[model samples]
Target: MELSELPSFDFESIIKSAVKKKDTHPVMDLPVDYEEFNLTSEFDRDSITAFVKSGGWAVGGYLEKRGVMYSAPRYADGRNIHMGIDIWAKAGEPVYAVLDGVVAYSTFQNDEGNYGGTLILKHMVEGQEIYALYGHLSKESLELHINGEKKKKGEVVGWLGEESENGNWPTHLHYQLCIEDPGEPDMPGVVAKENLIPARERYPDPRILLGDIY
Candidate 1:
């Protein structure tokens, strides 16, 4: 069956209600089209920086790493845990959108230990207002993003930054998906394992819609 003919579901309602009441500087990745990814090793090249900076790299297959769902960023309420999949890329390299959308929120939320600069875009994917997040960027990028700016897929929004500028980590984009509303522009992306349930439910699995990481 054609993608256009796929049966519909109630996911749209869930997305609409969430958008109506969401959070600060909120806007809210894939790689430059999500060509491929390898998690077994550290991603150093622009093709892989996030993993080298953080603990894990991009998953090579379609699904998230085993046990990641229960993991902090991925676990339901685990704040420190993983929420969205990581895209390992190099610093200073231009970051591009996997699809088109409106810039919901962007800023230099320097309060946290990390996430020096962040950008959030709201895309109407499959008729749902899916929020995409980009964090750990060069200071210059934050100063340039204007709210409500419309960007097309594959457009270069900003470049990755050095470890010092990118929250003291190797240059890479810390991308994530959110539905619960961050409450603020720079709200915590990851949390301790204790808060996993709400985080999971509020931030439903983006993998459900993003197929084939590699």
Candidate 2:
């Protein structure tokens, strides 16, 4: 289906309502200038968790220096342009479906600085097929079902995973949207600087669906 043909979502209302009703942390309200913080600086998992717990989401990794986190050989040119929005919250916090869809993929990545337990849902909006990815989820999230399971909008799909199971990172949701399936339970959450334009075209800013939560 053409991208323009997809149905529009009430992103603002859905997100605002979700935040108000859930025990969400406000990431954008944090006092630190995340953009200027040294992305490559060494940080312990506990310290990172405490930072997010202090309140607000950290921003400014997209197409920037944060690429060090994904420096594996898989990432071309060691590029670190973040492609999704990371929602900071405590481990075990509930993550809900923003729309009705079927479970496309679910599995544990279990790699260093990886998504860990991830869930991908295949959604149909206005007859256009789209996909949503939720990463860093608890291992329990993978036990709930198998591929092709149907889910309803706002259903509790999973909870945040701890540092041990969530790629050794602080508890947070790595939320991303995709126009075309990447053919794996895992999708590229970050891209190379040279691929930024095309990647953006394929993976548009997830914050659109997330509303003002950023």
Candidate 3:
């Protein structure tokens, strides 16, 4: 049987409900201040790295229309709409869990332009099951926990990866929240223009969980 489409979500409501249950932990150990970058086709890895280095820490918004950066030959049909939030900071920066969850997947994707060392945690918000994918992490992160391992809020989950280990891109964290199960360690961080609506339905903005960092 063909799979039915997933239901849409009111992310704002979900975020409020989750936050009301308990306070969240800091995902990265950086200060509350963050410099936001709006990436476009003109921006490349070198330019972006330079920007981050000069500022110390930066963030990329969810669902931003970007090009070239996600233009690798591996991506077919010009998947330029970003589906996750990109947190840019120094390599080896420790990442923590924002809420109670279980380790769903921890694996290193060796393919070029892939997530590389990635982790996905299963969470519950208002009795609704959701998944959080943390990409571009250090290989060591894969060993931080086994499948089904439970993690508490504010607990150290893993650290950011170096460029060499993080999908061959500049060091950063690709954080995404999916209402539907990805069923694996990986999910598309960008989608084709035509899939934007469904993609948005499937992956809500991560900022809802991360709090105000812009």
Candidate 4:
């Protein structure tokens, strides 16, 4: 999983988890209510794509520059490939729960992309605890999430942030699927090349439940 190199997703492993956790799964019961960048001004979309393609400082880079090393540079490899999918969208956009779970971790990591404030929910489906991550959010999003508690299927966790706080590019949500305890209050939301094997093993691919979008 090099940053510039995309790897064939391990679907068999993903399927194994799905088969084992299908009944009462956290994500299955949770419904996604967020809006994708389906309506940015036509000009905006083109500009965003061009900027990211040019590749100076975009989504992952902003995080890296600030210190979230795991944003790129896979733990298994050094090319820095990304495993979690990033969906580009607009600011103030509504981000809802994709499943029912308790807010396990929430913080304003303003440190690196600091996830520009992030949230992680944990739950058990068919008995295994699973985690969900939401990143690059608006300031208000800081207050909107379920917090040290659980949220219903359609609750608005928060809105997307504008370019500035969201780490310089257009606003969007960087969601991930994790299987770890999500760390105490604060820890690495993204991992560098040193521990990716463990992260990927615990988290698996979120797209299996999220529906591939990158």
The numbered model that scores best in lDDT is 3
Which pairs of residues have clashing backbones in candidate 2? 26-56, 27-56, 27-57, 63-81, 67-80
- RMSD values for the candidates in order, in angstroms, are 9.0, 7.2, 4.4, 8.1
Candidate 1 overall Cα lDDT vs. reference? 0.55
Evaluated against the true structure, the overall lDDT of model 3 is: 0.82
The residue pairs in collision within model 4 are 2-81, 3-79, 3-80, 3-81, 30-98, 30-99, 70-191, 73-80, 75-193, 179-203
Q: Any idea what lDDT model 2 has?
A: 0.69
TM-scores of all models?
0.61, 0.74, 0.90, 0.63
TM-score of 1: 0.61
After aligning candidate 3 to the native by TM-score, how far in Å is the CA of 149 from where it should be? 0.5
Order of quality (lDDT): 3, 2, 1, 4
Task: Say which prediction, candidate 1 or candidate 2, comes out ahead on TM-score.
Answer: 2
Candidate closest to the true structure, highest TM-score: 3
Candidate 1: give its CA RMSD in angstroms: 9.0
Instruction: Output the lDDT of residue 160, model 1.
Output: 71
lDDT of 4 by residue, 63-169 (tens): 12122233322223332324455665446657777667789877765543446767787756546676778777776777765556887665778777766676554
How do the residues 90-140 of candidate 2 rate in per-residue lDDT, one tens digit apiece?
A: 687778887778999999987777898999998765455668889999999
How far off is residue 141 in model 4, in Å? Answer: 1.3
Superior by TM-score: candidate 2 or candidate 3: 3
TM-score of model 3 (CA atoms) = 0.90
Error of 4 at 151 (Å): 0.6
lDDT of 3 by residue, 171-197 (tens): 789999898789888888998877777
- Report the C-alpha displacement of residue 79, candidate 1, in angstroms: 4.7
State the local distance difference test value for candidate 4.
0.55
